[model samples]
Target: MSSQLLSEDFAENIVTTARTATGDSLRSVTYFTRSDFDQLYLRDDLEQDADLNTFVGHEWRGYRETQNAYQESELGQCKFTVRSFENGYLLRVAEDRRGVLITTDGLSMQSYEEIAEALKRMLQDADDEEA
Candidate 1:
């Protein structure tokens, strides 16, 4: 399904940004809101299965529920989060109720940091426009 929260150009640009940054190691790119999600890109080698849905559901719920816990933490506001898996890593960058979940096959810290910063800026700009 297409995204309701993100514009078509926005979604496409996000996918492009991710693919350009991660190259061959990129696994999947999903854009999610608190209640809905859109899979923008999934590598040809990857299977389209229930796990994709499960991952989106898990991340969507986690983003909504976990932010509050960190709201008053010593580290201050959450800019993004990264979960490393056995074969890959999941990077989450969000603004308010919307976010992007990016999965990749082990990228360097510099790559992740760059992508997170770019995504955070995009999300923040979108949020600012909407407000």
Candidate 2:
């Protein structure tokens, strides 16, 4: 686990991609702020949803600790992991049987396909720039 600050432009793309991919309404797509991540606690609004709470529990404890610690202690740090497709950089947030959360920004996703595509696009753009 590691933390990296995204440029505003890149962050915007990430948010847009996530929104488009998930078909999430603009208002429902909440961006994670530093404080939000720092707390390592799910938002009550999110927790209150009956559909989502089924997956919420102690399982998130480890992820919370790892993410919170990384955010606090590591700056510009990232985890390099091979996603299933093995085709792009994966900015994974959390994963479970229900869904996955990920982003180049701080957006969360419940769709694995969306996560993979957004990550693929983000990584491709980065590669193009490097070249």
Candidate 3:
């Protein structure tokens, strides 16, 4: 069995989990992963203004579905839905059968790199534990 914990602050949100070992182990191994969603003003070069509304609209729709699930399950705080005004993007991180899935729309190259790094770390940890 695996368990999860979700947390958030003004600047970032995180999800950590303890996964059960397949065979036999007294203690389950734990791993941590996180995402940061920050708001920023529109920038002319990026056409941030036009894109912001589109992303925001999508986020609102997604948020409602997520919130409903949380409310029904009584796991509201464990889920997160965030919009980044500065970057004109919407980010969502949710648990899935395979593991954690982090998806982003309208994210800059730099932001994508950061997210990739976090995912890589989680994968590395899981691989190391299995070795």
Best of the candidates, lDDT: 1
lDDT of 1: 0.84
Q: 9-28 in candidate 1: lDDT tens per residue?
A: 99988988888889998898
List model 2 lDDT by residue over 5-102, tens digit each.
44556555655665566443222222233223211212233333433232223224444655566765646432322233232222343422111233
* Candidate 2 lDDT for residue 25: 27
Compared with the true structure, what per-residue lDDT tens digits does model 3 show for residues 82-114? Answer: 345453434343332112333233545555445
List residue ranges in candidate 1 displaced over 4 A: 1-5
Model 3, residue pairs in steric clash: 40-86
Among all candidates shown, the one with the greatest TM-score: 1
Candidate 1 backbone clash number: 0
Every model's Cα RMSD, please? Answer: 1.9, 12.5, 15.5
Which pairs of residues clash in candidate 2, taking residues 3 or more apart in a chain or in different chains?
A: none
